[model samples]
Target chain A: MIGRLNHVAIAVPDLEAASAQYRDALGATVGGPQDEPDHGVTVVFIELPNTKIELLYPLGEASPIQGFLDKNPSGGIHHVCYEVEDILVARDHLIETGARVLGGGEPKIGAHGKPVLFLHPKDFNGCLIELEQV
Target chain B: MIGRLNHVAIAVPDLEAASAQYRDALGATVGGPQDEPDHGVTVVFIELPNTKIELLYPLGEASPIQGFLDKNPSGGIHHVCYEVEDILVARDHLIETGARVLGGGEPKIGAHGKPVLFLHPKDFNGCLIELEQV
Candidate 1:
């Protein structure tokens, strides 16, 4: 089952501008950008009191977010992550309930070095959901 | 300054189905729907440990989310709300930094009964941001 709301990922066309907007305009503590080759994105974490806002930018040629950026040129909220106690259990329960998991239904080590799986957006009211083991 | 991420609002085409999905598939504690006429949406809150996921549906004829739902028929993330110590101070600072506030630059009573203001999505990496005085 989902526990805590992990982070909301926003795919931005310009990572630096987005980071600056959060840090200066919003007056929030934002971390430096870190390239996530495995995830095919560069991420900057905006630390809030209760959760994080992840600014994502396409990293490589096959960056998954590139398509998202193509569709949303100015970028948009890409996904919302929820922390789960036991990911396998959560996946199985979700499967039994007819929810489809993405990427062949296998958990991959996420950007945070935690096991994570993405659920199909269609099954989740058009919201891409990432379940991270915590 | 932005303090806590109060909630992430997801505009859904079908409110009941979306609520059921969160309640049954995601195993989240979903609250009953409350029609916020002034905000022009009916909302169902999914209480997470640290924050909340608000499921929004069009309430009346002039529902703001109706346009969003029209563009994204399956529904999608509408906005992200962040708590602020003082909304007016935050507004003035944001304005000084060239960020545009929506709704004629005045704080309106949000669905949570708190003073809230929406920022222009164009200036916010294409994400609608809501600032709530908490």
Candidate 2:
């Protein structure tokens, strides 16, 4: 079961501008960009009191977020992550309830170095959901 | 300045089905639908430990989310609401930094009965941002 709202990932066409917007324009504590080669994206963390907003930009040609940026030229909210206590149990329960997990239904070590699985957007009201074990 | 991420609003085409998905499949604490005629949406609150996910559905004829649902029939992330200490001060600062506030630049009572303002998506990495005085 989902516990806490982990972070909301926004795929931005320009990572620097998005980071600046959150840091300067929005007055939030933002971290430096870190390239996540495994995830195929560059991420900047905007730390909030209760949660985080991750600014994501495509890292390489085969980046998964590249397609999302292509569809949303300016950028958009890519996915919402929820923290789960036990990922395997969560995945099994979700699977039993007819929810499709992406990446061959296996939990991969996520950008945060935690076991994470992505759920199909269609099964989640068109909102891409990432379940991270915490 | 942005403080806490108050909630993430997801506009869904089918309110009941979406609520069920969160309640049954995701196993989150879900609240019943409440229609906000002024906001032109019916919202169901999914209470997370740190924040909330607001499931929005078109309420009346002039529902703002109708256009969003039209574009994304399955539903999608509509906006992200950030809590502000002072709505007016936040508005003035954002304006000084060249961010355009929607709805004629005036803070209106949001669905939560707090003063709120929406920022233009074009200036916000294509993500609609709502600032609420909390």
- Distance from true location, Cα of A48 in model 1, Å: 0.6
* Total clashing pairs for each candidate: 0, 0
- Writing each residue's lDDT as its tens digit, candidate 2 over A1-134 gives 79999999999998888888898989999999999998899999999999999999999779999998888899999999999999999999999999999989989999999999999999898999999999
Q: lDDT tens digits, residues B11-85, model 1?
A: 998999998989998999999999899889999999999999999999999999999999999999999999999
lDDT of 1: 0.94
Q: How good is chain A of candidate 1, measured by TM-score?
A: 0.99
Off by over 4 Å in 2: none
Error of 2 at A82 (Å): 0.2
Which candidate has the highest DockQ of all?
2
Local distance difference test, each candidate: 0.94, 0.94
Fnat per candidate, as a fraction, reads 0.90, 0.92
* Candidate 1 colliding pairs: none
The per-residue C-alpha lDDT of model 2 at residue A24 equals 92
Q: Specify the CAPRI tier of model 1.
A: high
Model 1, span A35-128: residue lDDT tens: 9999899999999999999999999999999999999898999999999999999999999999999999999999999999999998888999
